[model samples]
Target: MTLLKLTGIVKTFPGVRALDGVDLEVEPGEVHCLLGQNGAGKSTLIKVLSGAHQPDEGTIEWAGSTVQFSKPTSALRAGLATIYQELDLVDDLTVAENVFLGHEPRQFGFSSRGITRRRTRELLARLGHAEIPAGREVGRLPAAGKQIVSMARALSHDARLIIMDEPSAVLAHDEVENLFRVIRDLTAAGVAVIYISHRLAEIREIGDRVTILKDGRTVAVNLPARTTPTDEVVRLMTGRSVEYVFPPRSAAAPEGTPLLRVSGLARAHEFSDVSFDVRAGEIVGLAGLVGAGRSEILETVYGARKAAAGTIEVDGKPLRRGSVKAAVAAGMGLAPEERKSQALLLGEPVYRNVSLASLHRFARLGFVQRGRERDAVGAVTRSLDLRPADPRRTMRTLSGGNQQKAVVARWLVGGSSEGGSLRLLLLDEPTRGVDIGARAELYALIRSLADQGVGVLLVSSEVPEVLGLADRVLVVREGRIVREAPASDLTEAQVLDLVMAGERAATAR
Candidate 1:
C-alpha cells in the first residue's frame, strides 16, 4: 500500500498558480526523489503535504484514508514532518528541548527534562550521531549535527514520513555522504522520505524512485533513479535536453596593470599570506572545499574583515581595512555566498534592493528620487534578464536565480552611476541554490562583465565552475593558497588531488 499520496493537487497564490493538478505518491521504505527547477511548484507541493498550506483542490490520502491537514501541528500528529532548507530550530535551545519543544514528555502534566534528554539521545544514536550531546545548544553544533538534530525532532514526533528540502546545500562532501548513510538507515527501518534536491548525481545515488515536476505538474513519475539518463531528467525538469552550459572563454588574455591587487593578505586563523592580482577584463577563481576560508578571504579583501597583515589596493590605491563603506567607495563590490542573510533585504522591492549601493545617485535635495532609481535599476535587471521584469515585485517573491541576478545587478548599477565604476567584483558561490537554466545565464553574465573590462574575483566550491569560467585558478587548502595555475593547466581530478593533499598530510602527521 502507498504510505502517502496526493491526487490532482491545485494551489494558487495572488497572481501565481504555484501548483496545478499535481500528483505524487510515496511508498514505505522508499526514498522518493523530487526534481524540478526553481519556481516549478516543488516548494508549493511540499507545503501542501506538510499542512503549511491547504490545497485549493485535491485529495490527500495517508495510510489508505482520505484526510485534510488544516495546520502544521495536525500533519505532525498524523506522522508527517517537513525539514526546510533553512532549519527552524531555535539557536538558543538545547538539543533535548528542541527535539521535544511543543510535545515534551511529561509526568503528571509537568515537563520532564530527564525523559526528554534520554529520548533525544536515543534518536541521535539511531541516526549514527551519538556524539551530539543533548544538553548542548543547537547553535553550537556544526551544519551536519544541526541536520541530525532536525531528524531527531521528527523522530520524537514518531514521524513515519519526513520531507527534507535541499538538506545538503550547506554540507561539505564528507558530511553529505554521512547524511546519505542516515537516509539509507531510515529507509531500512521502513520510514518514507520525500527528498528534494537540485543535484542529479545525489538523486541517482540516494533515491529509489524519481518524480519529475515541471510548470506545476508531475511530468514523469516512478522512473528508476539509477538507470535514468541525466539528459532525460534535465529535459523533464527544464523542458530542455541540456543543462546550463558554461560560456566560451575569452580568446585574448587580460592586459594592463591589475585592477585589484592584494599582497601578503592575512586574517588570523582564517587565511594567511594570500596574494593575487586581477587585471582588467580578467576572471580569476578561487577553488577549494567548503570552509577552506575562501569566503573569509573575499570578505577580508572587500574590507568586511580587518586584515591582520598585508594590503588591498584597488586601481593602485590602498583601501581602508575592515571598512565596507571604503570598499564600495573604491569601486569594489561583493555578492556574498549567503545572499539572503548577508546581502538582500527580502521585505523591499526588487528595484530598491538593486539600487541599494547606488542610492546616492538617486538622491537630490535631501530627498530620494524613486522614478530615477527604478529606471536605473530596471535597465540593469533587463540586461541580466531578470524574470517577470517587474521592479515593483517584492524581493522575496522572486526565485533564487532571480534574487542572485538582482544582487549582481546592484553592483552593475553602482558601477555605471555617478557613484563610481566597479573595478573589482567579488562573487562568492554566485550560483548557489540556483537552477541549471539560471546558472547558464549567470555564467554568461559573469563573462559579459569581464568582457566589459571589469575584473572579476570568483569563489566557488564546485571545481568545474572555477575551471570552466576562470581565466586563472587558485587552489586553497587549510587556510592557505597551495597552488596557482592557468585554468587550461588544471583538470578537476588534479584540483581534487591538490585539495585532498592537505588532508593526507595532516593525517600522516
Candidate 2:
C-alpha cells in the first residue's frame, strides 16, 4: 500500500516560488530517494511534508486518509518523523533521554528510567547498534553514534514513515555501510523511508525507487534504481547534460614551483608528522573519512587550530603556527568545513561577508571606507556569478549555493600578486552539501584560481570528488598521511583501504 501521497504541492517564499504543483508518493517498506539541485524546492517539499511549513496549495493522503499537518508534532502523532541533515539530537542530553525525549515511556504518571533504558537498548539493537550505552551522554558520542540514537528516537515515536535528509553526508565510509545495513533492517520491518541526499552512490546502493525533482516540480517518480541510468537522474536533477556539467578537465601548468610546502606537521592527538607540497597552479586534495584529520591538517596550516609541532612554508619561506593574522600575512586563506559557522555571516549583508576576511584593505587609517569595500565585493560577486549581485542583501537570505560563492568571493578580493596577501587557498569540504552544478562551478573556479598561480589544498571526505577535481590526492587516517596518489588513477576502494589500513580498530567499509 502507498504509505504517503502528495499532490499539487505548492509553496512560495518571498520572491521564490519554492514549490510549484509538486507530486510524490512512497510505498510501504521502500526507500524512495529524492533527487534535486540546490534551490530546486527539495527542502520546501520536505518542510511541507514534515509540517515545518504549510503548503500554499496541496493535499497529502497518508496511510489511505487525507490529513492536514499544521505542526511537526501533528505529523509525528500521525506516525511520520524526519531526520534533518543537521541531526536535531541535543548534544547535552543522554542517549535514552534523546531517544524518548518528548514522550518517554512513563509509569505512575512519571518517567520510567528502567523502561526507557530497556526500550532504548532494544531500539539500538534493532538498528544494529549494541555498543552505545543508553545512559551515556550524547555529547560525548561520535557523529555516527548520535545518528543511531536519532534513528532510534524516530522509531520511539512509532513513526511508520521516516524521512532522512543527507543521512550519509557526515558518516565515514564504514559508518555509511553500517547505515545502509540499518536502512535495510528498517525497510525489512516495513518502514517507508524518504531518503534525500546528494550522494548518488549511496542512492544507488540502498534506494529501491527514486523520485526526481527539478525546479519546483516532480519530474519523474517510482523509477526502479537498477533499471534507470544514473546519468538520467543526473540530467533530470541538473537540467544540464552530464557532459556539460562535468565537462573536460581544464589544463593547468603542472611544472610550477612548490607554492606551499609542509614538513613534519603535527597537531597533538589530531594529526602527526603530516607533510605534503602543493605546486603553483595545482589543486591538491586531502581525502579521508570525517574524523581522519583532513580538516585538522588544513586548520593547522591556516592557524585556525593549534599545532603541537610542524613547519609550514609558503613560497618556500618557513613559518610558525598560531595567530590567524600571521597566516594571512603569510598569504593563506582558509575556507573552513562548517561554512555557516566559520565563513558566512548569515545575519550580515552579502557585501559584508564577502569583504569580511580582508576588511583592512578597504579601511582608511582608522575607519572602513564602504565605497572601496563595495567596489571590491561587487567585482568578486559578479565574477563568481552570485545571484542578484546585491551587496545590500542579507547572506542568510541567499540559497546554499550562492552563500558558498560568497565565501569563495572573500578569498578572491584584495591581495596583489606581488604582496603576501592571496597566494594559497585552503578550502575544507568546499562543495559539502552543494549541488552537482554548483560543484562543477566550484571545480571550475578552483581551476581558474590555480591557473592564476594560487596553490589550493582542498580537503573533502568524498574520495570520488577528490578523484574528479584534484590533481593530486592525499589519504590521511588516524592523524597520519598514509598514501598520496594522483586523483586521476586513484580509486575509492584504494582510498578506503588506506583509511582502514591506517586505522586498525575501524570497522570495514
Candidate 3:
C-alpha cells in the first residue's frame, strides 16, 4: 500500500522558502531514505509531515486519503512519529515516564506508574534491549542507550510510519549494526520508515528506495538506494561531480619546533600511556571506534579533562592540567565533538560566537570594539563561505555545517599574523552530523589551515576520513595505541582490522 504520499510540498519561512515544491512517498514495509545537503529542505519536509510546521502549499495523502496534520500530537495520533537529531526526551524523566509521557495510562483519575514501567519494559525487550532499566533517568544513559529509548517511545505510539533523522550519528559501529537490526525488524512487521543520514554507505545497507532533495526541491524520487552509483547521488544532491577526495599533503618540510607534544598522557580509566607529537604544518589523525577513548584523549589534551599523568606541551611550554584557559593561552584551539553544547553559544549572534575566542583583542577598558570585532569576524566567515553571510544573525538559525564553520572561524579571528593565535587545532569528529557537500568544504578548509603552518590533531570514527586527511595515522583501541604509521602506509581495511582485532582480544579477556 502507498502508506504516505506528499506532493508539491511548499513551505516558506520569513525571508526564506525552506521547501519549494517538494515531493516524497513511503510505502508499507520499506525503508525510504531522504538524502540532501544541509539547507536542502529535508528538515522542512519532515517537519511538515510531522505537523511541526504546516506547508503553505502541498497535498498530503495518508492511507489513500487526503489529510492534514495541525500539530505534533495530531500527527502522532495519526500513526506518524518523528525522532529528531537532537533527542526530545527530558533529562530528568525516567525511561518509563518518557515512553508514555503525553499519554500515560490512567486508573481512577490517577497516572499509573506501574503500568507505564511494565509497558516500557516490554517495548524495550521487543526492540532487543531488555537490559535498560525502566526506572533509570534518561540523562544517565549513554548516547546509544538514549537512541534505543527514543525508538521505544516511537513504538509506544503504535506508529505505522517512523521518521528517524540521523539516528546513527551518535552510535558506534556495533551500535549501528544493532540499530539496523531493529530497523529490519520494524520493516518486517509492515511498518514504514523514512530514514535520513549523511553516510552514503548506510543508505546502501539499509535503505530500499531513495529520494534526493536539493535546494528545497525534490531532484530525484524513488531511485534504487543500493544500485544508484554513489557519485551519481552526490551529483544529484550537490549539483556537481564531487568526489570524496582529500587534498594533497604539502611536500614542503615543516619548519620550527614541534607545535604539540603529549608525553605519556593518562586519564585514569579513559586513556593511558598515550604519547604523540604534531609538527607545524602537519596533520595527525587518531582513528578508533567510538568509546575507544579517541574523544577522551582529545579532551584530556585540551584541558577540558584533567590528565592523571603526563604533560601536554605546546611550543615547548607545558600546559596547566585541567585548565581550558591555560590551553587557550598556550595557543591551542579545540573544536570539540559536541559543537552545540561544548563550542557554540546558540542564542548568541554569529559575530559574537565567531569572535568569542578573540574577545580579548577586541576589548579595551572592559569595553568591546564592536565595529572592529564584526569586521574581523566577517573576513574569516566570508573566507569560510558561511551561509546567510550576516554577522548579526543568531547562531541557532544557521545549519549544522555553517555552525561548524563558525566554530572554526572563532579560532581564526584576531590571531597572530605569522601563525594566527592558534598554533594547534584539535578536531574531534569534525564532520559528525555534517552533509557530504559541506564535508568537502571543511576538508579543504582544514588543509588550508595546515598549509598556513598550524598543527592539527584530529579524531574521527570514519577510517577513510582519517587516512585521507592526516599526514600520520594513530590507530587507538581499548584505550591504547595499537599501531602508528604514515597515512600513506595504511588502508581503511588495515585500520579496521587492527581495531577489530583489539575488540576480539578484549572480548576474549
Candidate 4:
C-alpha cells in the first residue's frame, strides 16, 4: 500500500504561486528522492506536506485515507515529521529535553526526566552517535550532533514517514555514511523517507526512486534513482544540460607582489602557524572536512577572530589584529559560511542588506541618501541576476541561492568606493544549501571576480569544488595545512587522502 499520496496540489502566496498541480507518491520502506533547482516549488511542496502551509487545491491521502493537517502539530500527531536544513532545537535545552519537548513521558502529572534521558541515549546509540551526551545543551554540540538530536526527536514520536531537507549539508563524510546507515535501519523497520537534496550522487547511492520538479510542477516521477543519467536529471530541473559546471581557469598565472599575506597566524586551539599569500588575480582554495579550522582561518584573517600570534598584511601594509573595522578599511570582505546568522540581516529589506557594508558612502553629515543606496544596491543585485529584482522585498523572502547572492552583492557595493575597492574576497562554503544550478552561477561569478584582478580565497567541504574552482589548493588536516599544490596537480582521491591522513603521511615523508 502507498504510505502517502498527493494529487494536483496547489499552493499560492500573495504574488507567487509556489506550487502548481504537483503530484507525488511514496511507498513504505523506501527513500523517495526529491530533485529540483532552487525556487522550483520543492520547499513549498514540503511545507504543504508537513502542514506548515495549506494547499489551495489537492487531495492528500495518508494510509489510503483522505486527511487534512491544519498545523505542524497535527501532522506530527499523524506520524509525519520534518527535519529542516536549519535545525529548530532550543539552545539552552539539553538533548533529552529537546527530543521529548512537547510529548514528554509523564508520571503523576509530572514529566519523567529519567525516562527521557534513557530514551535519548538509546536513540543516539541507534543512530551510531553514542558519544553525544544526553545532558549536554543542544547549542554547545556541533552541527552533526544537532542533526542527530533532531532525528532522535522524530524517532521518539514513532513517526511512520519522515522528511529530511538537505540533512547532509553540514555533515562530514563519515557522518554522512553514519546517516545512511541509520536511514537503512529505519527503512528496514518500514519507515518511509522523503529525502531532499541537490546532490545527485547521494540520490544514486541512497534513494530508491526519484521525482523531479520544475517551475512549481512535477516534470518527471517514478524514475529509478540509481540509473538516471546526469544529463537527463539536469535537463529536467534546469531545462538545459550543464555537465561542465565549473568555469575554466585563467591561462595567465598570478605573479608579482602578493595582494594579501598571512604569516605565523595562530588561534590557540583552532589553528596555528598558518602562513599563505594570495596574489592579485588568483583563486586559492582551502579544502578539508568540517571543524578542520578552515573557517577559523578565514575569520582570523578577516579580523572576525583575534589571532593569538600572527601578522596579516594587505598590499604590504599591516592590518590591525582583531579589528573588523581595520579589515574593512583594507578592502577585505568575508562571506561567512553561516550567512543567515553571521552575515545577513534577515528581517530587513534586500537593499539594506546589500548596502550594509558601504553605508558610509551614502551618508552625508547627519543625513543619509536612501535613493542612492537603493540604486547602487539595485545595480549590483541586477548584475547578479537576483530573482524578483526588487530591492524593496524582504531578505527573508528570497530563496537560499538568492540570499547568498545578496551577501556577495554587499561586497560588490562596497567595492564601488573611491579609494577602497575589494582587494581580497574570502568565501566560506559559498554553496552550502544552494542548488546545483546556482552553484554553477556562483562558480562563474567567483571566476569573474578573479578575472577582474580581485584576489579570492575560498573554503569548501566539497573536495571537487576546491579542485575545480581554485587555482591553488591547500589541504588542511587537524588544523594545519598538510599539503599545498596547484589545483591542477591534485585529484579528488589525493585531496581526500591528504585531509584524512595527511599528517601521518607528512611525518613518514
Candidate 5:
C-alpha cells in the first residue's frame, strides 16, 4: 500500500522555482532512493515534506487521506522524520538530551532526566551502539557515533517514514555495513525510508526503488534500483553520460627539483617516519580509512600541528616547525578539511574572505586598498567558475561547492607574494561535502593548478579519488605508511584490503 503520495508539487523561492511539478510516491517497508544532482530540488522537496517549507501547489495524500503539514512538529506528529546530511544534533547536550529533544518524557510536570537517560540507553542498545554513554556529550562522539545518535532520535519519535539525506557520506566501510543492517531492521519492521545519496554504488546495494529528479522536476520514477544501469541513472540526473574520468596525467616527466619534500616527518602518537616528495606538476595522494592518520599527516605537514621530528623543505629552503606563518612564507598553502570552521570567515563578504591571505599586498599605511582587493578576488573567483559571480555576497550564502572554491581561490590569489610562486598546495578532503557535478569541476580545477606547476599533496578517504587524481599514492595504516605505489599500480579493492588488514591488526594488538 502506498504510505504517502505527492502530486504536482510546486515550491518556489523568491527568484527560483525550486520544485516545479514534482511527484513522488512511497510504499511502506521499502527503501525509496531519491537520485538527483545538486540543485535538482531534492532539498526543496524534502523541506516541503518535512513542513520546513509549504508547497505552493500540490496534493499530499497520507494514509489514504489528503493532509498538509503546517510545521516540523506537525510532520513529526504525523510520523515523518528527517535526518539531514549535516546531523542536527546539539553538540553541547548529552546524548540522551539530543535523542529526546523537544519531546522529553515528563513525570509530574517535571522533566524526568533519569527516565530520559535510561530510555536513551535502551535506544542506543536497540541500534547496536549500547557502548555509547547516555550522559556523554554529543560533541565527544565521532562522526559514526553521531550518526547513531541521529538514528536513535528518529526512532524516538516512532516515525513510520524517515528521510535520510546522505546518511553514509561520513561513514567508513564497516560503518556503512552497520548502517545497512539498521536500515534492514527498520524495513522489516514496516517502516519506510526515503534515501538520498550521490553514491550510486550505495543505491545499488541498499535501495529497492529509485526516483530521479533533474532541474526541479522528476524525470523518472520507481525504477528498480539494483538493476538500473549506472549510465542511465547518471544521464537522468545530469542530462549527460557524466563518466567519472580523471583528467589525463601529463605525459612529460617533471624535470626540476621537488617543490615540497618531507623526510622523517613524525607527530608523536599520530604518525611516524612518514616521508614523501611532491614535485612541481605532481599530485601525491594519501588514501586510508578514517583515524588512520591521513589527515593528521597532512595537518602536521601544513604546520597546523607541531611535528615532533621531521624536515620539511620547499624549493630547498627548510621551514620552521609548527609555524603556519613560516609555512606560508616558504610558498606553501593549505586548504583544510573543515572549511567552515577552519578556513572560511562565514559572516564576511566573499571578496574579504578570498583576499584574507593576500591582504598584505593591498595594505598601505595600515589600510586596505579595497578596489585592488576586489579586482584580484573577482579574477580568481571567475577563474574558478564561482556561481553568482558576485564577490560582495556573504560567504555563508554560498553553497558548499562555492565555499570550497573560494577557499582554493584564496590561495590562488595569495600564492606567496614575497616569493616567485605557490610551490605547494595541501588539500585535506577537498570534495568532502560537494555534489557530483561540482566534484567534476573541482577535480578539473585541481588538475589545472597542478598544470600551472603547483605541487599538490592531497588526502581523501575515497580510494578512487586518490587513484583518479594523484600521480603517486600513499597508503597509511596504524600511524605508518604501509605502502606506496604509482596511482596506476593500485586498485580500489587492493587499497581497501590493505587498509582493512591494517585496522584489523591494530585491533588485535
Candidate 6:
C-alpha cells in the first residue's frame, strides 16, 4: 500500500514561490530522501507534510484515504512525526519528560514518575540507545546524545512516517553509521522514513529513492539512488554545472615568517599535544566531525579556551598564555561557529557590533566617541555592501547574511587598525547561513585576507566548502591532528575516512 502521496502542492513565501506544484509518493518500508539546496523548496515540502504549513493547493492521500492536517498535532495524531534540524526538546526537562511531553503515562488517574521512566527506557532500548538516563536533565547531555533522545521522542508518538531533516549533520562518521542501523531497523518493521541532508554520500548509502526539489517545484521524482550520481543531484539542486570531482591543485604556500604557531597545546577532554602553524597567505582548513575537538583546538589558539599545556608564538615572539586579550594583542581574530550566539551580540546596533573589538581606538578615556565609531562603521558597511545602510538598526533586525557581514566587518575593520594587515583570521563556518552570492564574496574575502599575509584557519563541517576554500586541509579525529593533505591531494572520501576511524588509528603522522 502507498504510505503517502502528494500532488500539485504549492506554497508561497514573501517575494518567493517556495513550493510550486510539487509531487511525491512514498511506499511502506522505503527510505525516501528529499534533496535540494538551502533555499530550495525541500524545507517547504517537508513542512507541509509535517503539518507545519498548509499547502495552497494539493491532494494528500495517506493510508488509502485523502486527508488534511490543520496543524502539527493533527499530523502527529495521524502518525506523522518530524525531527527538525534544531530539535524542539525542552532543555530544562528530563529525557523522559521530553519524550512523553504532551501525553504522559499516568497511574491512578495521575502522572507517575515510575511509569514514565519505564516507558522511556523501553522506547530508547528499541532505538538501540538506552544510555540516556531517564532522570538526568536534557540540557546536561551532549548534542549527539540529545539527538538520540529526540529520536526516542519521535518514536514515542508511534509515527508511521518519520521525517528527519539533517539527521547526521552534527554527528561523527561512526555515529552516522549507527543512525543508518537504526533507520534500517525502523524500515524493517514496515515504517517509512523521509530523510533530508546536505551530505550526498549518506543519501547514496541509505536512501532507496530520491526526490529533487528546485525553485519551489519538483524537478524529478522517484529517481533510483543507485543509478543517479551525486553530480546529477547537485546539478538539479543548484541548476548550474558543477564539477563533482576536483581539479588537480598545485600551488606552494607562502614562504614567510610564521604568523601564528602553537607547540604542545593540550586542552582537557578537547585536544592534546596539538601543534601547527599558519603562514602568511595560507588558508588552512581544520576538518573534523562535531566533538572531535576541532573547535576547541581553535578556541585554545584564540585564547577563548584555557589550555593545560601549550606555547603560542607570533612572528617568533612568545604570546601570553590563557588570555584572549593577549591573543588579540598578538593580532589573532576568530569568528566562532555559533555566529549569532558566540560572535555577535544580537541586541546591539550594527555599528556597535562592527566597532566592538576595537572600541578603545575610537574612544577617549573609555568613552566611545559616537562620531568616530559611525565613520568607521560606515566605511566597512559600504565596503561590505550591507543593505539598508542603517547605522541604527539592531543587529537582530538584520537578515542572516547581512548580520554575518556585520560580524566580519567587526574584525576586518579592527584587524586593519591593530595592524596594517590582517594577522590571523580564524573562521568557523564563515559562509554559513549566507546566500550563494554572499558565500562567493566571503570566499573572496578569505582569499584577500590570505593575500594580505593573514593566516586563515577555516573550520567547517561542510566538506565541499573546506575543499573549495582552503589551500591545505588538516583532518582531525579524536582530539589529535591527523593527516595533513594539500587541497590538490585531498578528497572528501579521504577526509570522511579519517573522521570515521577515530582514536585507535588517531592519525598522528
lDDT of 6: 0.81
Q: Model 5, stretches more than 4 Å misplaced?
A: 417-420, 503-509
lDDT of 3 by residue, 1-509 (tens): 69999999999889999999988889999999999999898888888999989999989999999999999999999999999998999989999999999999889999999999999999999899999999999999999999989989999999999999999988889999999999999999998999999999999999999999999999999999999999899999986776475888988656667888899999878888998899999999999899999999998988899999999898888989998888887778889998998889999999999987778788899999999999989999999999989999999888888999998888889653223478888999998888888888899999999999889999999888999999999998889888888999998988888888756634432
Kindly give the stretch of ten consecutive residues in candidate 1 with the minimal lDDT sum: 500-509
What would the per-residue lDDT of candidate 2 be over residues 374-453, giving only the tens digit for each residue?
98899889999897678889987776778888887887787532244578889988887888878888878888887787
Task: Indicate the residue-level lDDT of 354 in model 6.
Answer: 88
Candidate 4's displacement at residue 315, Å, is: 0.7
lDDT of each: 0.90, 0.84, 0.90, 0.91, 0.88, 0.81
Put down candidate 1 lDDT per residue, 135-215, tens digits, no spaces: 999999988899999999998889999999999988878889999999999999999999998888899999999998888
- Ten-residue stretch with the least lDDT total in model 5: 500-509
Worst 10 residues of 6 by lDDT: 241-250
Model 6 Cα lDDT, one tens digit per residue, 139-254: 99877788889888888888899999878856766678888999999999888999987667788899999998877788889998767976688778775555233323326677
lDDT of 4 by residue, 1-509 (tens): 99999999999899899899999999999999999988999989888988999999989999999998999998999999999988999999999999999999888999999989999999888777888999999999988889889999998888899999999988888888888999999999899999999878899999999999998999999999999998899999887786448999999899999999999999999998999999999999999998889999999998899999989999999999998888888888889999998888999999999998888889999677999999999999999998879999999888888999999888898663344888889999999888878888899999999999999999999888899999998888778888889999999988888777744647622
Q: Model 6: C-alpha RMSD to truth?
A: 4.0
Question: How many clashes show up per model?
Answer: 0, 0, 3, 0, 0, 1
> What are the runs in model 1 whose C-alpha is more than 4 Å off?
416-418, 503-509
Residue 354 lDDT in candidate 4: 93
The local lDDT score (0 to 100) that residue 428 gets in candidate 5 is 92
The C-alpha stretches of model 3 lying farther than 4 A from their native spots are 253-256, 416-420, 503-509
Write the residue-wise lDDT of candidate 5 on 1-509 in tens digits.
79999999999877778899998999999999998876788888898999999999989988888999999998999899999987899999999999999999999999999999999999999888899999999999999999999989998998899999989877877889999999998899899999998788889999999999888999999999999998899888776675475788888766678888899999878899998888999999999888889889888887889999989888888888888888888778889988987999999999999988889888999999999999999999999999869999889767677888999998888787564357788999998767677788899999999999888999998788999999999988878888788899999988887788856534432
Candidate 2 Cα misplacement greater than 4 A, ranges: 243-253, 364-372, 415-420, 489-497, 501-509
How do the predictions measure up, each by TM-score? 0.96, 0.92, 0.96, 0.97, 0.94, 0.84
